[model samples]
Structures are given as C-alpha cells and as structure tokens.
Target: MDKFVTRSRAPVEEQEVELGNLPADPGLRIPISDYHPNLKDKVRRAYLQKGACQPSHNFKKRKIENLLRRFNLNWFNEYKLWLEYSVEKEAAFCLYCYLFKSDNKQSGDAFVKEGFDAWNKKERLDLHVGGPNSGHNQARRKCEDLMKQNQHIDVTLNRHSEQIKNEYRIRLGASVDCLRFLLRQGIALRGHDESDGSINQGNFLEILKFLAAHNKEIDGVVGKNAPGNLKISSPDIQHDIVNASAVETLNYIIHDLGDDLFAILIDESRDISVKEQMIVILRYVDKRGHVIERFIGIAHVPNTNAASLKVCIDSLFAKHGLSISRIRGQGYDGASNMRGEFNGLKSLIMRENESAHYIHCFAHQLQLTLVAIAKNNVHVGSLFNMIANLVNVVGASCKRRDILRDRQAIHIYEALAIGELASGHGLNQETTLKRAGDTRWGSHYGTLLSLINMFESVIDVLDTIVDDGPSSEQRAEASALLEFVQSFDFVYSLHLMKNVLGITNELSISLQRKDQDIVNAMKLVKLSKLRIQMLRDDGWDDLLAEVSMFCEKFNIICPNMEDNFQMKGRSRRKVHQVTNIHYYKVEFFYGVLDMQLQELNTRFNESNMELLLCMSCLSPNDAFAAFDKKKLIRLAQFYPNDFSSVELMMLGNQLGTYIFDMRSDNEFLILNGIAVLAEKLVQTKKDMVYPLIYLLIKLALILPVSTASVERAFSAMKIVKSRLRNRMGDQLLNDSLVTYIEKAVFDGVLNESIIQRFQHMKNRRGQL
Candidate 1:
C-alpha cells in the first residue's frame, strides 16, 4: 500500500484565479471634432462596452454657486438606461448616442462627440428627454431594443441583414402573388400537361411567369436567370411556402385563443379516392360578439369507428400543441359514431374533459326532425312524394325545363297585365322550379314556394304534356297527375304545409345562423312554437277560405263544411257523421302541428336549454345585460377539475368585480365576440386579478356554437384536394387548405419574413 512515490509529497496546491471586471476607461481627452468618424466608432465601442467610468471624486469641477457643481455623481444613478459619464474629459455622454447616433446636426452632438461639460446647466437633463419624436428618444429606443435578448444582433442578422431582407422580400413577394392567384380563382396548382411546349402549366407556374415577365427585378433573380437552383417556383418550394403561411395563420388563431377554453367542430367524409378523412374547425365568438369559424385542419384516418376517430383526434391535437382538457364543447353530426352515449367521439372527449359537452348539430337536428315527421305522418309524407314526382316528370329534361319556364313567363306576364300580381324589381325576374330532394328538408319548402309562385304555369305545362302525348302512357300519366293536383285535397295539403313548415322553417333558418346564441335560440324556439299554436287555434277559417278560392279559380269542386268526409278513392269506407271540418282540422292539422312541437321539444330538451341559457352570460350584446355572476359560477362548477369548490366560491366575488370593471373600462366598451372579450380581459390585467372568472368566460367562449365550420372545411376540402388531386398527401393538403381558407392572415405576412424562414430551413442554391 505504501509503494507510491512519497518523495514529491511537498505542498502542491493550485494557484487561485481572478476574474475582475473589465476596464472602464473613459478614453483619450481629444476634442470631439478632432476624432475622425471612423475612429470615433472604435473609441466609442470600447468605452460603451467597458461601461460608464464615473470617478467623480477624482475629477475637478466648475463652481456655479458657492457649492462646486461637479458632474452630478447621482445623475449617473438615474437615466442609466441610456446615460454614461466620462471622467477623462470632465463631462458626461450618452452611452447609447455615442455608439449609435447617426448624425451630428441634431442637438449639437454635445453628449457624444464633445461630452457635455456644463455642470451648472444640469437642468439640461429635462431638455435631454425632449419630445416623443426627439433624436435623443430615438437613440434611446435603439439602445433599449438592442439590449433585449430577443432583439439582439446575431452573425446572420449583422453581416448582410439589409441585403438579405431586400432580396428575400422580392422572392417571397413573387411566390405569394402566385399563390394568391391560384387561391382566388379556385384553380388547381399542378398541371398534367406542364412542360415547355404546353401553353398553360397550371395556374401557379403561369402566374409566376406572368409576374416575372413584367417585373425586371423579379426576372433578374428568379427562375432560370436565378443564381444556382433558387428558382423559388418549384413544386416543393411552392408547397413549403404555402405551408409556412398556414403555420403563421394558425399561430395567429392560437394567439387569439390563448389558454382560454375553446370548442371544436368536426365532420368526416370520403375523398375522391375513397379515403375516410375528418375535417376539424374552430368556432368561437370573437371579442366583437361575431361568430368566427376558422377551418383548422384535416386528419386522415384508417377508420371512422368511435375509438379510431378519438385516437386520430388526439394525435391531431398533440401534433398542434392543443390540450384536450381545454375543450369546452364538441359539435358533430348525429351519427351514432359521433353521438353514441358510451363509445362515440363526444363521450370519449367528455371522459377526459367532462365540460366538453356534446352538441348534436342544431341545423342537422332540425333537418332530421323535419324528415322524420314527414316520413312518419301519412298525410304530409304522401303529399311531398307527389310533389317530388310531379317535379320530376314536368322538368325531366332541358327541353321540358325550357317549356316550363316559357309557360311560367307567359302566366307571369298575364298576371302582371291583369293586376293580379304586383310588378316589382325582383318580382318579374326569370325563375325556374327548384326540384325537391327527400333528404333536404329545406328543398321541400323551396319547391312548394316556387310552385305557388308559378301555380298557373305548372298547370299549363301539365296540360301541354297531356295533349302533346309523346306516348299514350305519358299522356295517361299526365292526365292523372293533372287531375290529382287540381283536387281540393291537394290544394288543402299545399297551404297547410306551407303554413306549418313556414313557421318551423323560420326557426330552422334562425337556428342555422352562424351567430346563433343560446339566448336567441331559446327565444326563436319559443316564438316559433307560439306562432304554430296560434295558427292551429285560429288558422282553420283562413286556410279553408284560401283553399276554396284557389279551387274556384282552378274550376275544382269545393266541398261544403257541414258535409260528411269521404275518402278520395273508388271504394270509400268512412266513419259515419264525421264533418269535413272535424276530419281535416281536428285530426290532420292538429296531428301535424303537435308532431312538430314534440320534435322540437325532444331535440332541444330542458337540459340543453338550461346549459345554453347559462352560457349566454358570455353574450356581449345589450351592454352585457345577460351577464350573471351567479350563473357564471354555476357554469364553472360544471368543470370541477378546473375549478375546485374553493375556487368556485371565490369565483362569485371575482365575477362581480370583473363585470363592474369590464363595464367601466373604456377598452371593453366595444366588443365583438367572446375571443375578443378574453383578449381585452387579458390586456386589462383582469385575467390575473380574477383567474376563475376568466376561466369561466373562456369555457363559455369555447362551447360549440355550431358545426357549420366543419361543413365549411369539408366544402373547402373539395376545393383543395379535388378529384384530380385526390392522392395528395395529408399534410400537404392541410397546408393548402389553411392558406386557401384564411387568405386574410396571409395577406398581412411580410414577404421578406417567409423567404428568410425558407432560406434558414436548409441550404439552398440561391442566397435569398
């Protein structure tokens, strides 16, 4: 153990090292004028980097009063963000101005070149501050901005920042112009026939060429003339540019959303290649109280089952840095895959975020209700089918459509001349019958409305078809259709549905509004039911009179009100002594009206209405009259994970303070949407003051306004990943869709910034 060398065991401690501060030398006492401009930069750099060398005790000073006024040693203590003292020249200098001031003409350069020596005129410090636009202020801003870690200069930003910025601007400007051209025209970016010989190589390249041919600056630097391979117009480059713009847009959206609660609207459909793809959109009320629906992205899925869809959505959220816990509402279709209680997408999201309430799309639910009622009731169901079939035969071909239109125009002119119809600007315009679809509930309303407007014309077309007789079979069919349509029963059904659906359709349209809020939705729903009930109670005589008058005009027989009701068939078996009024009004009218009311009540139920009313506290309308602190606390209780009992208790007091502050604060006097309201709260520092209130507001904001955004994204999906480009990759398609949908965000992005990002991404052939 003792075999080691003990001979050199004398003390062998290492020496201590010192890292004293850098020298603060003021510099040579040369006159400010004598120092050359080039030499001043070096001298100033050393002194500024060395820092203010204020050794006032060692320096002599001039006396203005009995007290000698040395450079106010304490003045160095103040204005330190920009001021510096120089003991060598017995004067003070602006550390910032000495290093960065551009010209000597303003303010005599006393602080920089000469170093101000007027100790008695210390009040000049006030003068030095000057106005907002003064040179000193400008220099101070440069100093402050440069000192920030984020705004500091780097090797790249220093060496060729100006040149790079200019050239990059030109390059990105060209690319953006090309992208805008394609998006505005709703045209494809790639061409199957893209070559030198081809006249048009798609909208993207052709637009670039057109831009290059016109601008000499652009032509000199891009395409074949471009240095190296920096054509900037290649397919990959175009896609990258578009994707970069999309990222910026999403950043703006996320920035607006902040950490606030938000809702997602999702819809799934098959692409042209038969791939099941899901589209996601964000819907929130902006600060100005306007509904803003942003098309966020599209996800490609292996399957559309509940679990698979949930996984796909989670993956998408993670990829975009979104948290499922922040979810407030989920708006999707009524498909069991989306709305199933235990395994649907809504239930899955709610399991994680119990506050992420599922909303079966109001528009979709209304449509379904109309379709269901029609299918269930024998009277309205057969009536719509007959109308659909009638439209099919009369307008089967272009020739038939032309004949119908011509007949309608003749009837319209006759009606106008006889003063049966008023002539107005839009009234006499050419019109065509819109065919009703079984699935489109609105289409039924449209078809009947059009028929009533062109009732005389339809009869004329049918009469021609019966006489012309392309075939005896068609002639017989036309004869039967004509007889059926002219009957009192058909006329009766027409007006009845027109009145019933008219009430419900108004509610449907109102509910579909993008700006629809729960408060207004409830009012509309109630108003519609009231109107329907009024019609049921008092509309019997009016409808009967209208039907009778129409029958008299068409020469169809009108039955007496007191007569026994009979079925319109060869073999009639009817209950004895049942009056026509009782048959049609008591049974049919009451049945249709009651069914519609039941559907509305069942779909919207009491629970949903209460939730909606609670959310309406976020409504910024009417000077915030709808805001309720108690209700908001109740809203927060829905998310106990976010707000514990203690937080909820604190939230009530916070809510009152927040509302009072919001009402009094000038900045919040005018607002548009919930998103904007959140922003204002953050800006006013109320978010920190009332965290729970802010959380509740954020929750209310993120609740699903509607699934219209999802539909819109799918609509845009068709435009971006069309039948021709069905094989486009998912990420690429998403990038294109974002840019195409949110063109406004791209419009504000500086061209230079995009180009700089592109250049920094990887080494390129050109230096743009």
Candidate 2:
C-alpha cells in the first residue's frame, strides 16, 4: 500500500502508447514482384547504393531428401548479382531485371515482380538468365558494366595496345639509336643550323636520318613519317631519353652500392654560366670489389661557403634518398672554406656523422707539396718563374714554335753526328716545352725534362732572339736571358730541383691513378720520402757532375768550384764572399732539398701515416698482406659505434678463422678488392661469419684516396655547360653529364626499359 501510494503520482499517461502504423525501414523491406517500373527502379537504386542486404538469419529453408536443408548460401554466392532473396516474402528475387527492366517489357514474374517460392523448381534460375541479348542478360550486362569501372587495374593494355607499342618502339628505337651513336662519338647534339634545308642539322637529327635512310623499319617510324606529337627526335624527347639513361645508370650504381658505407669525393667550381656548382662523386667498393668512384651528382649552389655547401649536400642526399650516416669519408681540395676546422663543410658533415672523416685530396696534396717546397726558397721559386717565362716565350706563336723545333732538329743532328745523343722511337719524337701549372701533376717534371732534352735547341733559340728580336729592348732582354740561362748557376739549380722532383713525380702520378689504393699510395709515399732522403744525401755530387757534363756538351760556361760565391742579382754589398762549394753545396742544394723533405714529412706526418697504416690493413690486394687482424682491431677504434667492446673482442678470432677459410675458398682467393670481397662473402654466405672484419674492410675501402674523380667531373662540367650552352639549367646539365660520363652504363640499358619509363610518365594517344 505504501509503494502504491508513492508511485501513484502518474497513471496511464506516464507511459507512451502507439496509436498508428509507422513507415517501414528501407533496409528491412523486401523486394516485390511486378511493381511500377519507377518504384522498383527507385528501390533498386537504393539497394545498389546501399549494397547487397543478404542477411544470414533471414535466409529461407526447406526440407529436401528427408533432410532439413536450408536454402544453400552457395546459390546466392554463385548468382550474387541477379539472385536476391527476400525475408518478408520468404522468396527469391532477381536484382538485374528489377533495376534495369523497362516498363513496356514483360518478363516471367517468378523472380522479379513476384517473389519465387518454388524451391523445388530451382532450374528456373537458369531460365531467368535467358539468352545473351535477352532482357535478363542485358540487365546482367549493365550490372557487370557498372562494376567494371571500379576495378583499379585500369592500366592494362587495350586491343590497340600491341599496335601502339610497336609504333612507339619504332619511333623511340630510331631516336635512341641516333642518340646512342652521338653519345658514343661524344659529338654535340645540336648545330647552329637545324633547318630542314640544312644538310647537317645536328648529330642527333643527322644520325636519326642516316639510320632511317639505312633501315626501312626505322624510316617508316621516325621524324616526318611519325605522328606529329609522336616524333621522338624532338628536343624534349631527346632529353627525356637522355634522362632515362642517366636514371637507369644511377639505379645500377645505387644497386651496386647497396647498403654498404661509402665516401664522398667532393669538389666545387664555377660552371660555364659562372654558377657555383658542387660535383659529388661516390667513392665506394663496387660489387666486383673494385674501388669505384662514380659521379653521383652535380649540385648548384648560391655560394661556396661551408653552410651553403652543406645545405646543398644535405638536399642532394635527401633528394636521392641517401643517408649522411652512410658517408665514411669526404674528399675535397684543401681550401679553408672546405676544410676549415670550426665551420667547414667537412665539420658540418662530421657533426651529423662522426665517422665521416675529412681527407684532403691526395692528388691536390701532391700538387701543394710541389708548390710549398718550390716557394719555400727564393732560388727554387725564381727557377720555376724563369722556366714558365721560357715556355711562354718559346710557345707563344706557332712560327716561334717551328723555329724552336727546327733548332731542336739541328741540335739533335749535331749531337747525333758527334755521338752525344741516341735516337729512338719515343726518345726523339718532336718535343715541345710544356707549360708548368700549379695544379697540373708532373708539369714541373715535364718542363724540366723537355728543357734538358732540347737544351742546345733552347740555347740556339735564345741566341737568335738576342740577334733578331723585333726591337732593341726585346733583343737586350733576350740577350740577358740567354746569358743567365747559359751560366753554371742556372744549370745547377735546374738539375738540383729536377732530381728532387723526379723522386716524387711517380708518386704524384700514382696517387692520381684511378685504381690506386690507400695501402699502395701510403707505400708510395714512404718510398718517395726514402728516395728523396737518399737523393739529398747521395745526389749532390752526381747532379753536379751531370750538370757540368751537360754544360760541356752544350758549350755553356762552367764555373770553377774554388771561385768566390756570388748571387745572381746585382746588389751593392761588401766583399764578404764565400766559396762556390759552400754556396752551392751548403746554401742552395741543402736549402732546396731540406725544405722539400720538410714539406713532404709535414704533409704526410705521423697522424696521416697512422691513418694510412690503419687503412692499409683493409687492402684485399697482395694476398691480403694489408689485411691484418691485429692492426684491424686497432683501426676498429676509429668507428666505436659500429664496433664496440664485444665486436672488437670477437673480431680478432673471427678474422683468423676467415683468413684460414678464405685461403681454401676459391672465390675468396680470387677476390681482389674490398668491393669484391664484400660481395664474395655475401655470395658464399660468410658475410655474417666475419662481419666485424668485413665492416672494417668496407670502412677502409670507402676511405677516399683522392678527389681526381670529382675534379674530372668539374672539368667535364666545363665541357657540358660550355659558353655556347651556358644558359642550360642545372638539372638539364646534370642529366646530360650523368649519361655522358657513365656512357658505359647508359649503353648497357635496354631501349625497352627506357621507352617504358617514358610511357609511364604520362598517358599519351600512343603507348611509348
């Protein structure tokens, strides 16, 4: 009673009551037979939009063969498009006709207008499908067509695909053939006159025409015979093909590099347009175990400062999906801007990756060694200046060049008559004085050697200059030059420096060689230093005697060794003189020789020697003499992150086992480089066995030997973006150079792959 009284506030009105029928949910409604065309289509459209509603629980069932078998879901699966069943009617229906049948057309009402309930007469499903052109089949076709557009495999070929592909092949093949021909020949692509009336339009166009004229197949598919838009020899098309070749070549280079660590040989210069450009070459061990230096890219920058250059480099790595972490070393000319201690490009890279050690270009270092030693003493410096002046004066005009040559011939004839000289194929070839450049390797040697070979000829030329110069002033200058050159002082200095540079000239050339390894280079450096020391100690008397003999043969005056020493230039001073032996032996000879020794020692000092020694342990050459386990463990200290306490401890034992195994392993025995060694290890499934040792090998292999590759690339940049093509964009020039420099790789690329890449760039009327 108490509960009733408490809850008695509201009676019947408290609860809501339903009074009228509500509209049915479209999702729950069943398909009906023979409804108005518009109404059925409206429901069909809604069903199509909402998708199939074949609820599992709502499926009807019937007894068959004394078994309570339900309507098989397989039926709905097999005829999913046309066979839809209804829960409301407990019957089957046809979706195809329901949505697509016309109002005028009357069909069997079993499955469409009227829901079919005769499960025993399931054969009518086949009747419902009817003939190919029947209303049911037509409705089925419409449904199939509606779903076909949803298939994402839209890039498949159509019926005309083969025809289009063939035409594209012919057009592209002709163009590629022409372009490859031009690329192989290293000929220019365009001409000043490209007009149709011109005979030689360009290498590209003319080569294409030549191929077309030669081959009927090519003739039918290129240039004027091709579709206007499909003319594959257009500048843009030519460029695309070139770029394709470049991309393919780069892909191969990347594939060869794989995930192994690599170094960057970096150098910068102004392009033909005077734009600052950084040429980057990847120095890495290739699959063949060869230390390959590949031209990776040429990046154009606003300035050559460290920050700007770093930005450009970072951008390039990112663009190519490369990681700076992979850089084990960097090579560049030792400009303060590049090698600055605090904020140079090397410092910036090393900050990001500590292992990216900076190496001054060894080739450049050798050049600087020459300059530093030459400039360290005034006497040696004066000698170089005089030689340069002599070369310039003698090689100025071809007329003068002929005069010098004729003089050389006459001198050779006299020397031959007197049996003073021997003639040979390579020995007596027409010789010209080479201009000595600060950057040119072996230049000083060349100049000195040429002057010595043509000594009498040079003297004869100077004598003629003294007698028959254009003016008296010229004659006087020539006369003085002749006298100075003929003196014993000039010849002594000449032979002195010549002997010194001669010791290092081979080392310089070897350092610049493409296949030079750090181990070999380091050995060469030591050998050069040893030879220089030996020359300094034992070379004085021999050089003096040689100079004296040369003077006697050339009719130049020879000074007595006992005479008082006098400097070359005129200066008013007291007669506080020294003996000629004291001057030449103590002052001049020791002066130049000691300075060169000091420069070499300083440049290739202890730290450098240590690095090279540590690096030499990675040399796979010479039966792996440089591949020492103990020294390698020491080298592992350089990269602490890759090889820590555990790795370093295991590396020693693993290396011994690897070397022992490698000797018997034919593949390993034949392996010659860090690159090939790494590959062979992987191929033989031994990479993981001696991974720490291999890591060390990879590090050493990637350590830069020189920046000659980068320098060559910059030199090529000058040729690619010449004054005539100065306006060429950076990207265009890069693409052209990649193909030009790596022509071997580019040539190896199949025409089909390049054409396919071109086709996929954009949809065209014809497939490429």
> Which candidate leads in lDDT?
2
Q: What is the C-alpha lDDT of each candidate?
A: 0.68, 0.69
Off by over 4 Å in 2: 1-165, 413-427, 570-576, 606-609, 617-630, 656-688
Q: Candidate 1, residue 629: CA error in Å?
A: 6.1
- TM-scores for all candidates: the values are 0.71, 0.75
Q: lDDT tens digits, residues 1-768, model 2?
A: 001111122332212211001001112232333333334433343345333434333244677666554455578678865676554455677766765664326555666655676666667788878888878888767655544323313434433467667977787877777777666544567776776688767788887887888999888877678877667766767776776666667767766776567889887888878888888888887655567788877877778889988866755553343557678888887888888889999889888778787777776776788666676677677778888778776676787789999998887788788897797778777888878876666787888999888877777777887778888976787777777788887888788878877888877877876666666666777787788788878888998899999899778888788998876565638545888888888888877778777887887662356666777766567667666676777888788657879888888888788778877666666656555666677676676777777677667767777877776777677777788777886667877788778777777888877766554433344553
Residue pairs of candidate 1 with colliding backbone atoms: 285-674, 286-673, 287-672, 287-673, 287-676, 288-671, 288-672, 288-673, 289-672, 289-673
**Candidate 1 lDDT over residue span 1-768, tens digit each:** 011112232332212100011123233233323345444433443333334444323344577677676666577668755566543356677756655564446645777666777788878976877898777888767555533323334433534456654665677678877886676445688777665577767778787878889998987666666545445677777776766566666767765654445678887888777888888877665554345667777777878898988866655553343567667788887889988889988888888778788777766666776656755767677778788888888887787789889988888888889999898777678887778764344767788888887777888888988999689988888898898888778888888888776777867776666656545555666787788789978988898888888888879898887888886543554445578888888877788778877887888772366677777787666567788877777777777667888887777787777788878866776775555677777766777787777666666655664576666666677887787887887767777777777777766666655565554433344443
Q: State each candidate's clash count.
A: 10, 5
Kindly report the root-mean-square deviation of model 1 from the true structure over all alpha carbons. Answer: 18.7
- Indicate which candidate wins on TM-score: 2
Query: Model 1, residue 720: what's the lDDT?
Result: 77
Report clash pairs, candidate 2: 33-113, 33-114, 34-113, 289-675, 289-676
